[model samples]
Each structure stands twice: as structure tokens, then as C-alpha cells.
Target chain A: MSVKLAGELQSGNVIIVENNPVVVLKAQYNKSGRNSAVVKVRMKNLMTERISEAIYKADEKLEGVMLERKDCTYSYYAAPMQVFVDSEFNPYEIHEETLADITKYLIPDMTDVCEVTFYEGRPISVLLPKTIIREVEYTEPVVRGDTSGKITKTAVLKHTKHELQVSGFVEIGDKIEIDTETGDFKKRIA
Target chain B: MRRWDLFCRVVDNYGDIGICWRLARQLADHDGEGEIHVRLWVDDLESFAKLCPAIAPRSPVQAVGSVEVCHWSTNFPSVDPADVVIEAFACELPLTYIAAMARRPTPPVWINLEYLSAEDWVEDCHLLPSPHPTSPLKKYFFFPGFTSRTGGLLRERDLMSTRVAFDAAAEAVFWQSIGIPPRGNEDLRVSLFCYENSAVPEFLQSCVEGPTPIRVLTAPGAATEQVSRWLGRGLVTGELVRVGALAVHAIPFLSQDDYDWLLWSCDVNFVRGEDSFVRAQWAQRPFVWQIYPQDKDAHFVKLGAFLSRFLHGVSEPTVISDCWQAWNGRGRISFAWPNYVANLAEIRRYGEVWACQLDHAEDLANNLIRFVREQV
Candidate 1:
């Protein structure tokens, strides 16, 4: 169902645009000294694959979009697309183009549910978990008292039969959080 | 070519006005024959006058090179419409100017030149466009970045040549003329200028304890207060004190040109905030960056990204990394200082190479000319 916003939404706010819920990418707060504030929000249109930035008065209120989440199991990769089976055993396929950046984190039958974006009753995008536990392929041997500043090294990720190369310093067999959003290693989880 | 107007509100700092002045001068100088006429509207004409003595603050309008420097007032002037307009660092253009641009035949190339960043997404987001709802204006996002895909850093032609001809003896005489003493042989000459940072004490102690003497040239501001507190005595012009092996020299306030020379002359520069940081990079010397701290320590990520790219090929990467982290953390300065100094030669070479690479990027003025030509 199409949802209309009550007022203006700030940038970075996840909202319903048309029938699809999208995130506000940027918000410019324009107000002179002692003047009323106005917010100009730049939004990414999830369903149509376009971006539109609009301005609104600061006092304007925006309607929050309702997003639905469900438990799903990873089925298999079809070249660039990733397929997932929900609780009803219904298969939802996401194009490889959309999931290509975060595809390395998807492990089959792992039971981790994914967040799917729906617009106008059609899936538009997906949001991955902030951190994914992955095995470290390689890390330099840690030296004691050698906290020689800002160390960054590459590591590989091994998930069952799937092997992926990631960069960060962590020992082999160590599980670290890989932030799919930025493609940077967060930290060692366990 | 699109006619562009760059509005700079200099907030009393020479660096801010200095940068904007360079951008304006270069834009006008190079784009004279092109379709661009860059009208530089600055609030602080007095500060702008300090950089280029040719600027007559009394004159409401005066020409310096190709740039038309106007004494900016609250009331915007009515002028012919331009093809492009820029608001530096999100500074608000006069409402009248915006209204006029909205009334233009063809919408101007509106841009908000954002501060420099090293974050990963900046590459993708740089040069993105945003449309004005009420007006037909479409403002493009221009982010100054370390990477090539982004709008490059501001570096003027003859900057290197000017830096290269910096004579040490002449600099000493110039300082002496200003009543500052000659540099001590053993002192590690440093230029101190930054925002308030918690790590200042530890960093100071490390400099004090280091084998070589540290001669610090203090800028007026929080750094001046810091130097005063560290010495437990008020600083006067040309005052020198021996703390351990370090001989801290507090010099008088310098003009913008002298500041550039100081960066070129110093063994290491401790520069904080955006303007000095860019100047330090252009100096081609081994320097430590004290990033402006933010909530949630977001500056750490920016600092990390820059260090990772900056020290990518250095020998003994770990030592360099640790030193940078220690300085940034404002912890254990004693440990980091020695390692940093030992690799000074190599780091200097690396910095020079990096500066050379950055020089390859189009100067902001030249880029503006090219941008204006293509659009017009």
C-alpha cells in the first residue's frame, strides 16, 4: 500500500517513499543566525533506483514507515543473485547487483535472517547485520609491547566451503566482525 | 562556460581567508578568457588584506589579479546571473543572491564544497547532486578528498617554487627582525598550532625528554595557553627555556607567508584543524596530525584511513603506525617520539613523494576554470 509522509523527514531517517521504504541519505539544515530552521533532505528512492533531494521546514513532521522483518534461511547463490527461503519455505531471490557487496557474508543454512526492503509490495533492497562473524585467514604474529601504532593488515575469511579474502589483522581461526556496509573489519568477536 | 561566484566568510583566521583568497585569485587568473567570472565575497576584508596587501579594505570593490574582491555585507548586491555558484564549507550565500540565481535563464552550477575527509564512502558521494525544490537550481556535492575520484586538494602554482627558495639564514634574519632569536643547533624546530587537544601534555613531555632539543613556535590561541601552562610562566617574544634536552622557543605571531616558511623550515610540524593540516602536507616534511576530535571518536576512523594510505609503503610500518596512534591517542609520547625521529629521513621522503602525487591533481582554480568552460 502507498504511504504518504505526515510531514518532512530528516536525512538518515528510514521512511516510506512511494510504496518502498528508503533511507534519507543527507539532510542540510539551513537557517541563518536567529532565523527559523529548514531541512533539505536528500533521499535515495529504493524501488525506482533514483535519488531525489527535497527541502522542508524544520517543524514539519514525517510519518514513519512500517518495515517488516522475517526469519529466512540462505538457500544458494545463482551467479550474482542470492536466494533465501522464508518461514513459509517461500523463495525470495535478490539480484547479484544489489547483494554483490555483501554476498561474501551470506552463508547457506546458517539460520541468520536478512532484512529485505519492500516498496509497492515488491522487494527493493536488503540491509545486512552490522557485524558478521567470519574466520580470519591470516594475521601478522602479534609482538608484545609492540603496540607500534595504527596497524592494518589483510586477512582471509573461511565460511564452511566458501573462502573469501578480507583485510584486517586477526589470527587464523579468530572470528571477526566484517561490516558489510563499509567493507571494513570491525573487530574480533570471539 | 558557467560563471561562478565563490562566497567566503573569513572568521578572523588568516588560514581560512588565505585558502579562499588563493582559490579566488587562481579562479580569476586562469579563467579570464573563459566564461567564468569569480566574484569573491568575503566578510572580513581586513583579514583578506593581510594575505594580499593589494586588497583595499576601504574600497567596496577592487580587482586583485583576475578576482573581483568585494567587501561583503549583509545585504547582497544585484548583479548579472552566473552559470555556477559555490558556498564554501556550507556558508550561507546572501538570500538575495540565491533568489537571483533562482531567477536565472539557465540554473547556475550550484555546489557546496565540503570539508576534506578520508572516509571510504566520500569517494562515492563526492560530486553527487541535490535539487532545490522551490528553485530550478541543482547543487552538486563536491567533497575534497585524498583519492583521485573526488575534487582534489587546493594547491597553487609557484607554491613549490616559493617553498623551495626559502633560505634558512634569510628566515633567521626575518625572525630576528621580528625580535625572535636564531634557532638552536640541537633544538628540533617545531611549529605549534592547533585546536585544544587532551594529548598535549604527554606530547609535550615526550618532546621535553627526547635526546634532541625541541624549539616550539607557538601560534596565538589555545596552543599559546598550552605552552604557558607547560612552562609555568607567561611567554614573551623570543623566550627560550630548557626542559630536559628540549629548548622551547616561543616566537611572535607570524604573517601568512612567514607561516608557510615556518612549515618549510621546521623538522616536524604539529598542526591541528583543516587549514594548517593542508599546509603541512604541502610543506613536504614529516609531520604529526592531531585530528579534531568528535563525538563517538569518529575522527579516529578518518585518522586511520589517512594513515593507512599515507604510510602504505613506509619501512617499519608498525613503528610509524604506533607513533601516529600514540600521538593521536595523546598517550605515551616518550615511546613514540624516538621511533618517529629515527625514521624521520624515510618519512620525509615519503611525504615528499605524496606531495608530488597530490600536486598532479588539478588546482582548485584551474579545475574551476575547466568546470566553468564545460558548463558554459
Candidate 2:
């Protein structure tokens, strides 16, 4: 059975291949002049984490990759890692390497659902939000009439309980969103 | 082989005309089966003459190496119809030329040579064809890019050998001849040629404060003036200054070959816009790029895309990315120079590797021959 789902595909969505679920690591739309469009995707094995690339023809009918995302609350750390509880009260402990890049976005006692990529009931990779709200620590004074647009100043970021200064265009107390994948400021949250 | 007429309108710079002139020369010199005759039509002969020096301004058409240089003016020339026509950088071809191409027995190949980019989409769009609405001519989009799948970089045949044989002592003598003395010990020699930038103050500050000494060589422009204003003193005509540990040297304007030598001889080259940036890659040195700023911040996306590809295999990719971003952001120079200095060895290795990779790609002249042959 085949189904088509139309939305921006998030990284780590699990697709069935040879009756097994494979986790996607990246997805980008490939477009060309008068040529058929394709979703150029790279995926990693859920168990092995080995990456592979695949192209899905745009007009072709393909099986829909279904994934499950749940809202969860962070709980106490479980030695060398952190644990969280889903809405169904299921506890999931993730390794330090699994949450390596996005750990800075995590805040204890905060309730947010981690979208887990599942393949026949096994957890794969995690997909983080496009932007994360963080408080800025320091910024240089903005100058006037110098809008030649060729220079960037560095700024620091300070969370409520921790401080991590990043080099970017930001000001003190500005709630900026950081791309979990690229670790860049996406936008300033209103 | 298709006979192509490449039209170059020099926008008061040698770089633009220099590139087109080189391409035209390459096309004419091709030894393949099909004959390719290129008529290089240039608006500014004066600027072009500076690069070649042998170009006779009085002659309507003169042979320079292999290509025939035509003095393009308000009035178009009555010439044999070419099999292909190229409008460099979207420069409009003369109406007479356009009409001639339209009336040719077999419509000529029309191409709009686009600016180079490392963006993901460029690969997909490169060489895609567009039909002229009125004329039978079909125009192809030729994009100069860093990949095998795209039109390759503008490289001369002897470029690498020439760069290798370029005498350092001779270059020092040339600098002295142009009224700039040899750099002092502990000086970070820098060459600056760019559009007016607001980041000049911060860049100057960084140069003045960095652990290493800096000797900045500027082209004749507002960038020199900006440096002068920042120092609170007009550049002392012939002497270097001790601004902290940095020694800033202001040099005179250089010819194209001299500029290439400057790039080859410097610790860091801050190049603005197109031509010099490409040359810096050939220089095989660590560099900071100042992209031509766009109205809607589109250049930011272009800059980021390039950085993403350039730093793909680099050690301390984050630092390189940070330095590039800081260089292009709003007057922020705190991060780049310090981080870059700390990672000099790694950066230099990456530069060397990148230059070798670029060398494997076919040069502009050879690429033009192949492109024309396929189209014809």
C-alpha cells in the first residue's frame, strides 16, 4: 500500500525500506528548469546510525513515512545522560552523543515533546525545532550611519541558569532562536 | 565549431574586461576540429589596454595573441554572422549584432554568462537553456562554479607555473619601485582592494590590535581614505607606522599582474567583489571575502552558502564559519582575526588543498571551446 504526504519533511522521519524503518538525517528539495522535481534525502540507520542518500521522484506515488512525536517532561538524569517522560508516562533515556548538538537547548523541568524517529517501535534520531529561544548575554553598541553591511560583531548568550556566549548578531536579553542542526541564530522570537 | 562573439562592457575596471579578453583569446586559440573564431567586443579599450599594454586603441580591430579585439562603440560593426553570441554579465549586445544573429542561416548560440556561486541550486540551474522570445536564438545560462557539473573557474594555462615562478625578491623590488618599502619584521603583510565598506573601522581596529603586525596595501579608492581617517592621520607618504604591534603600509595602485603578485606575497588578502576574490583562490592563501552587498540582504545567503561548502572539510569549521560571518556582519571584527591567527596552520592547509582542487577543473578557455562545440 502506498500513500502521499505533503508537508515540509522534518529530519529523522522514519521511512520503511525492505520492511524496516530508516531514519532520515537531512532532506532538501532539488529543482531544475523544466525537469521533474525530486526530494533529495539522506538517512541514517536507526540501529547502526550509518548514513545513506536517496532521491524520491516528485510525481511518483510512494509510501508515506509515518513518525510519532509526543510531548514529554524532563526528569532527573540517569548517570551520563538525561531522562524524560512522555505524555503516556513512558520514560526514555537518551545518550550524551545522541543529544550532543542540541543539549544546549534543553532545560530541566521544562515540558517539551521530543519527536522520536521510530522504526517498527524502536527509537532513532531526534528532530529539533528550527529556532530555540535563548537570552543574549552581551552585544557591542550599535553604531550609526555605518550601514556598509560588511561587518559582524560577536555576542554572548545567557540562559536563566547557564551562560553560553556565541559569536553572532545579537543584543543582551534578546530571545533568539538557534537552528539545532547548524547552531546558528535563526530569528529573534517576538 | 560554433563561431562565438563574446561582448564585454568594461565597467571602469580591468577585471571585467580582463576576464572576457582572456576567454576570447582562449576560444580563438583552440586546436580542436571545429573552427571557433571569436570577436571580442569591448567598450573600454583604455582599461583593457592597461592589462595587455599591446592593445592599439586606434585600430578598429587588432589581433591580440589569438583573439581579435574590436572597439565597440555606440555604432555597431558590419561583420560576418557568428554561430554563437555571449553577453557577459548581462551586457546588452548591439542591435545590429542581435539582428545579424537573428538573420543567420542557422541561429547562433546565445548565452548569458552568470556570476559564480557555490549555492546548492546553481548546480541544477547551470547550462539550462532559455529561448529568446522574438528571435530564433536560444540562450543558455552558463554559470561559473566550483564543481565539475558547472562551468569551471577562469584559469589561464600557465597560471600555476607563472605563480610558482613569480620572484619574491622581484616583487619586493616592484613594490619599492611603486614607492612602498620592504615590510619590516613582525609585520602581517595585507593587500586591500574592495568597495567602500562600513566594516573598515573594525577591520582596521583588528589589524592594529592583533598579536601579529599588519601592513595593509590598499588600491586607489575610498578604502584607503577610510584607513587614513581611522588612524586620525593622513597615511605618511613612504613610511610604515607602529600601531601597537601592527605596521600599516599604504601602497600605490597596481596593474593586474602586479596585483596578482601582491596577493601571492601577502599573509592575508582582503578582496572585495568578483575578480580579486577569484584571483585570491589562485593565490592559494587564507583570505577574507567581502561580497557585493545587495539591497535585500540576499548576498548574506550567498555568502553563507559559499562558507558552508568551503569549510566542509576544514578543521575548526565552526571558527572558519564564525570568521566569515563576522567579516560580513555589521561592523564586527572581534572574532575573525584572533580565531584565524590561532588556526593559521590548519587554514593554510585548507587553502592549499582548495587550490589544488580548483586546478583539476578545466580553465575558462578550454571550457569555452567545449561549450561552443557542443552547442554548434
Highest TM-score against the true fold, candidate: 1
Per-residue lDDT of candidate 2, residues B153-264 (tens digit):
8877778998888676876876677677765565667777766777777877887777776778766666677778888978754546667766666776566777788888
Winner by DockQ: 1
* lDDT per residue as tens, model 2, A11-40: 656655434455556666643211324355
Q: Return the top candidate by lDDT.
A: 2
DockQ (model 2, Cα)? 0.02
Residue pairs with colliding backbones in model 1 are A19-A120, A20-A119, A80-A96, A148-B322, A149-B321, A149-B322, B1-B376
Question: DockQ of candidates 1 onward, in order?
Answer: 0.08, 0.02
